[model samples]
Target: MPTTPISPPPIDRTGRWLASLTQWVLAHKRLVAVAWLVLTLAGFYGSAKVTGALDENFTMPNSASTVTNERIVSRFDSGGGTPPLVAVVTLPPGTTASAPAVRADLRALEQDLARAVPGARIASFGSTSEPAYVSDDGRTTFAVLHPPSSVVGDNGPSGSEIDEETVARAAQAAADARVGGAEVRLTGNALLTSEAAGESGPAFLSETLLAGVGALIVLVFVFASALALVPLLMAIVSIPVTLLAVWGLTALTEVNIVVVFLVSLIGLGVAIDYALLVVMRWREERERGLSNEQAIVHAAGTAGRAVLFSGTTVAIGLLAALVLPVPFLRSMGIGGLLIPLASVAVALTLLPVVLATVGPFADARRLRRTDRAERHWAAWARLVIRHRIAATLAGAALLVALCVAAQGILLGSPEARSLGGTGAPKAALQQLERSGIGAAPLAPVEVLTPADRAADTAARLAAVDGVRAASAPEGAWRADGQAVVEVLTRSDTNSQAGRATIGALRDAAATLPATTIGGSTAQTIDFVDAVYGSFPLMLALISIVTFVLLARAFRSIVLPAKAIAMNLLSVFATWGVMTLVWQHGVGTELLFGVGPDGAVQAWAPVIVFAFIYGLSMDYEVFILARMREEYDRTGSTDEAVVRGMAGTGRLVTSAALIVFLAFASMATAGDRDLQVLATGLAAGVLLDALVVRSLLVPATVSWLGRWNWWMPERGRRLLRLPAVTPATES
Candidate 1:
């Protein structure tokens, strides 16, 4: 009789490589530890040098806004090279701003403000020849100011001291308070922008601290010993290294200030997450009576591989954002990608060495309370598997409901009225609107034409349906062979009606030779075009590439496809929640200290998608990889699902909380965009962990049974993955 041939052992190249790395780390633990410390020191030095290079200004090359910006720098004489800022003083109730007494007081106030701020050029009511400076009602009058140095020059911070926007509004407010007859308000694009950007420094520090504290509490609860400190140590080593890499990138191109916060906060959470997974696996191995070296090697072979794949998934998602033309989004992509790369480096190399040498001491003090809830994950897994259809249906229904809300999302840029602050900038804008001389002129749909046609262009723009006023102001310069006509709109620059006005102006100006429209409205239009222009392509590429990678990673077609679908659903749901709470004011007043103004920031949806897609996949990879491994060993899909959930549930929940708290910290920034970013991320993490991974994933896996792990021979060959003989259901 012919003997049954035994199949050769399945290829395990990744596991073997990881095991070798772990052994090497164990052999040179001391040297590895020292090297990481030295690298960390260098990272700190690089981070300090980078702080001065961070910039908030974003330039979209070749876009209408960029061309407009160039034109302004070359032609505008009023506000130095900077955009004009308006300071208005509303006369008490019935008094007119043009009255002799009111005019005299305004002139004195302007003089006082000029003195208070060095290099200020203020055109007070009595000094300026421009009719726009005073409202027709005479109830409101304003002054235009610009920094003397900023005019005719463009520069960013480059030295030990970072450059800051001049706070002329503060000085003007003080002067108004001192003079006391009229109500003084400073509202302009410059001042309002400064208020929003000014909070980054303090916000960064606060978010970082809060996230760290929250993570620390969770880590302590999870490990219940000195072992809790290891993840933090990894984070301490990871952040500076990531920042240094970003600083190096800045040498080649511009990097946004927001990237620094992302590196500090998100990087910290990701670093700890990688470390926690590895350490927990190592502890499990040790509990099975393995030697320290053996445990480290085993943990590296299993959990380290998961961390590597997970980091790669996240990095791929972030780097995909580079496909967008927007510089700010690109910077965030590159910088966000660096976080995982640097964190993975620490987790794979330095973490193993640390654990090999110091882990036992920390593990000695295990949890004394012996909480039974920690062991309940296995039971939860059994219950879910027993009622898989119910769990799957309920989860799908909830996710679908949430996604329906995304249908109502309205995208637009933020406006002062909706920024939710009591600062001088907000007050000033309010006063300007109340006085019927709001900053509409400051955000006109600029029409650039041949100098000869400037008059004709202005006349045409003025005739547009939404045009409030249009002028080819006298004395405007034309160094670039173009004349500028400012077309003011009746609606706010970021409003729907305002955007419609921009379209109408463009249509009206289309007949004019050499005409181009540029201004706030133009910028908004360009931004939307750039984002959506390639968004569908970007989304397809990311999805296809992610699916291919996951297929190779888990060696299953159905699982990877399901994972992609589930992740996309999670993203849509998160966007819906964001739209409801932020754009629609569902909880704006109670949660964010401001009311919704009918639109979400234009960039928010794309930014959140890039982040949440990758992050949601993180939990998917973590949980499903374990189940895959268990299934391979047991040849029973049901057993694998239950065992995987029992082994990974606590780790997944804690990791999710760590990241959620980190994002939630962004709410402390007090900016609408930041809050939206925070909300999307926090909500995505919670939903993915508790509902998607915990309920949907297991239920679906159980329902699919053996098909969950099936891979055809042709497909396995195509992907160059190991082949496995089919096993019958247990």
Candidate 2:
């Protein structure tokens, strides 16, 4: 037999560290196991605090609206950040509000509402005696409910508005109005935000359970033994630990309520994935005939190294959120970042100990077995390697087509029409609008100035484009020698036209000293600018940091670069799918029980991007790291690609499916933003695993051949990596 070429020792510091960690974990298996259990118990104890601290309100600090609200709070002790809830009171056809019978009914209705929700200060035609509160047609009028600022706590004024129970009750109280042959209905920023957030808690719970069940099933298929339970156990432990860490974070800063859903759903997927990668590697090492201890060490050196780098990539992708300048988004980033880091910690330490103690029992039963080479994946990989250019071009063409479809996406806050037509609020708003009384500005723009300038400022604003009306009623709102003028727009304040109008008014107000514009519309402009203004920098930071870390892991220059490039393509493709489904309304109505809005929700894109970038890398690292390992042993690019696929193909697909299920469950919340987010993540995982990771990546690597592993001698030395000659065609 020909002598085998001697393989060089691993010079990678990361790998050595991982190997050392595995040894320590294995040596103290019992102690590590007990410590993890205690940590998990602590997490359960802290989860309630995290839950209580979450707030859904979106705020842009130092924005026009924020400054205006602060001034109102400090001076008038009112009009902080409360969006007015509109109670549409419409008389029966042929009836008018002036009718004595109608007036009596209106008064009773007002009393009923006050009795129903005592805390929100109720302002209506019955309570205020203001002609403007009623429609010019005399058949319709409205009441405005102001949510108390104190209930919002220290997070901010907007926080009170998103309290699902509070808003739902307000809407219900309005819907229950039945006096004076008139029907009462509620539709406003407060109600709309409530409807979206109301279902999040139950939906998140459902998604977590669904994902858990799905993961167990997938693990069974992959392992075909009790060993499938190993990852699940790790997930149970890791999820709680991550939650506990997030809870501690909340004590020091504002955390978004949305982060709870993200941590639970996304965290579940990531935890199991880390465990799966480690378990699969351990199994492979065992099959190679190494002792249990030696196998754990070798698996840790290879798969553990990948998990460490992959976790960093996942965390780095989420770090982009910290650049957005919104505390809620930043909290989401922090919450998301914790999942991978916590999972990595568990995987490197607790996981090996479990493998050393409980893993053998689970692995003992093997109803289905893996061979030295997984025949199906090997054949498919060989097929792609042989026809590499065609595979690469086909995948690229599909991605390009998807990107083109995404180009027409519209982005804005949801319109009344987009909130769906089934709710009581929807029915009321629609009825009022048909009679030419559109949903009035529930969140009116506030123009603040000296008391003397109030009338002049109001008159000037009334003349501006898109202003339906402006008023500075005497004694209406005054404090600290300052006056407040309310300006109503022709469009719903959160709509695109409304935001455009707000921008123009801001430009006009520049000439007026000490006059500030504040409302939902003005805040939308600031929120978008603050987040997107810094996105390019965030993208660069994530990509650069990830590339360096991945390069160190693979010990090659080309692999990490190619991996990053492919991930961007996948992300764009995902956005295309989101745009098509949500913005374009391709299949939303029939599938999700909601009609397509013309625009995606304001905050969905950045959150989705941050999560998708990291999640996509999770699968990318798992597959490519295995390929890198194979290439070092075989020194043949084609063989390495084929064998790596054979080894990791099922595991990657299973992991992707698990994550997809987790995100897909979010659609069940019956909220448009949740649906869009679910669609983006679910579609991204499918395309990434099936198209990018499965086809494009392998084909690209095969076409590049030995060049895929190339590094200059100087570069190799700088990174302190082992020497390797590039392999030529056999």
Candidate 3:
């Protein structure tokens, strides 16, 4: 049969090498199963005692920030100057946002809060903070509540505290506060982020589990074996054990649960995901009458190499996150690094051993009726093949349009209303707001300059364009030899205006030769800066590694380029959708829960993009591999592209579905901000899986024709990549 060039698989693929290795590993699946069972028992039992929903953003670099938060926490430990928060208060009709009744009500509300909250020694609130109340326009007013903390060293409760009664009061007060005219709204970090995390966290769990199971089910169905679940189970072992390890390690180091979760999910998903590919390929080798050990050796050599490339590509891509200055990025990088490393370990060690032990499980689902989805995917492939160029161009065009939209997206600071799930802390914020002291929404931008430079920096800031009202002097803070400067935001403090103030202050301080800004807002600006600057490095990492891996995998440079292009395209499209829904506020009001007034959080885009890029690459690899397999067999690029599309489409779609479901589940939580984020992710995943991968990727690959695989022939030798080898197993 004359073979033609295949663009790449329209379907997602784990590649031939992965399939073969999985087959070889299945030989000793029983031993792998037993080992996993024991490990699960030991790990789960150990962590069971402390198992519960933690309110803190699992990603915070608690080590560094904890000290600062603790200091602030300790000051009011006995409760003195700090005010009682009253949120969810009613305001009189026809009164402006800053009207007297609203202002008086704020004071009354603060007093009411002091009287209502039983545990405090002292509390205060009034109309003075009113400018910040109702958000300057007076639509939202909140009195500050300084919850009295336990005396120093007394452990004044973990933020919202796990106690039931306290939680109940917080809730009841919020609900009852909407009396006399105002509808109360409660929000605060403790409540907001907790709720946000609650919504997104479980969805993540569900996505991981479902993806793992879905992959397993596919394997069993493909092999007509009931035991296909074993290998997948082997992969699941990595997630929980890894998470606990991540938790304990984070207590000592800087990693967080998000890192742990992502790594574990990727490790489990990709590991098991790749493991299946390796196993399937190895099985083909076995069916060819190769001896068990030879098949294992062949699988390892061939599928193993592909697994190595895929894992290495993914690991390298994610590790780029480390270059970022923030803890979240570092956590992502380190976690990403760990997952693949772990995956490699299992694939080479436990996987190989298990496959040898439980090859019988491979046949368990062989006789089951073929899953309908696979057939549907096959039909899709034929249609794509029949109209390759037009299909491809159409797909490419769509992705490009989406990509453009994604680029236009914006972000804002997350607010209490945005935080949907974490309830108790939110109640506190609400209580504070209802009290009518403004600044509830203010993320204080604290600045400290050398005492010598303080006045000048303060003066420059005082005179700077956006200074709503610079305090008589820089407010007092405890930075040594540094005068603290607090600049009330003038509209754009959280927008370009806010960024500009930060820049001007920074620039002015730089000119002073001794001034600097350091506070939550300042830190946020810095963090955003760090993330923005490092994003290129992250993209470069993915691109370079992808280029290398693709070239090697296909023995051609062009294939990798096409794959990466598609992956990026998926990201762009996802972003465009997010920008429209989350940013422009044209139609996003209802989905995210809070009023669409707040801008998107500045940090969400980088983080979200990071996730989108990495996961899309996962799909790209799967598709490319399938196409590669077909190309290798028939030597026809076009035919191979179609066949590969048919082969891997169902799996990729299912994988996307699981991921989508995981993210969307977050929307159900209490925090509105998180709900929006979850919605964005869910939408992105759906588009990526069904639209980009299924339709666009296939069509584009078809249209690109041979050019999709067109690499500069002479350039391949320049990278000095390892000599590619066909799998020994099959």
Q: Which candidate is the best by lDDT?
A: 2
C-alpha lDDT (0 to 100) for residue 183 of candidate 2: 65
Better of 1 and 2 by TM-score: 2
- Mind giving the per-residue lDDT tens digits that candidate 1 earns over 85-148? 5667666667776667666776676676666555554555554333445667776777655444
Q: Which stretches of candidate 2 lie over 4 Å from their true place?
A: 1-11, 53-57, 73-80, 89-143, 151-184, 192-206, 371-373, 421-424, 669-673
RMSD of 3: 8.0
Ranking by lDDT: 2, 1, 3
Off by over 4 Å in 1: 1-11, 77-84, 87-184, 189-206, 369-374, 421-428, 431-442, 476-482, 671-673
Those runs of model 3 whose alpha carbons end farther than 4 Å from true positions after fitting are 1-225, 244-252, 279-304, 348-368, 371-379, 415-441, 444-467, 470-487, 490-519, 585-598, 664-684, 700-730
| Candidate 2 residue lDDT tens string, 1-730 | 2212222226266777778767767667778889999999998887766788776567778877778877865665445555666778778778777777766766776666666655445555564455546677777877665555554333222332535566677767766767566668877765554453333445566778877898888888888899999888888888888889888887888878788788888888888889999899899878888777777777788788878888888998987788887888888898889999999999899888888877878899898666633888999999999999999999999998998877765565556566654476677677657656565556777777788888788878878898776766544366677887777777766666777778878877777878888755566567778777888988899888888887777777898899888888888888888888777788976777566666766577777788888988888888888888788778888988998899888888888988887887777665556777888888998999999989998899999988888787887887777776666555
lDDT of 2 at 663: 85
The TM-score values for the models, in the order shown, are 0.87, 0.88, 0.71
Cα RMSD (Å) between model 1 and the true structure?
5.4
lDDT of 3 by residue, 74-168 (tens): 43242111112235443455555465555565556555555656543221124344143344444544543435554112111112222334434
Q: What Cα-based lDDT does every candidate model obtain?
A: 0.75, 0.76, 0.55
Report the C-alpha displacement of residue 405, candidate 2, in angstroms: 3.9
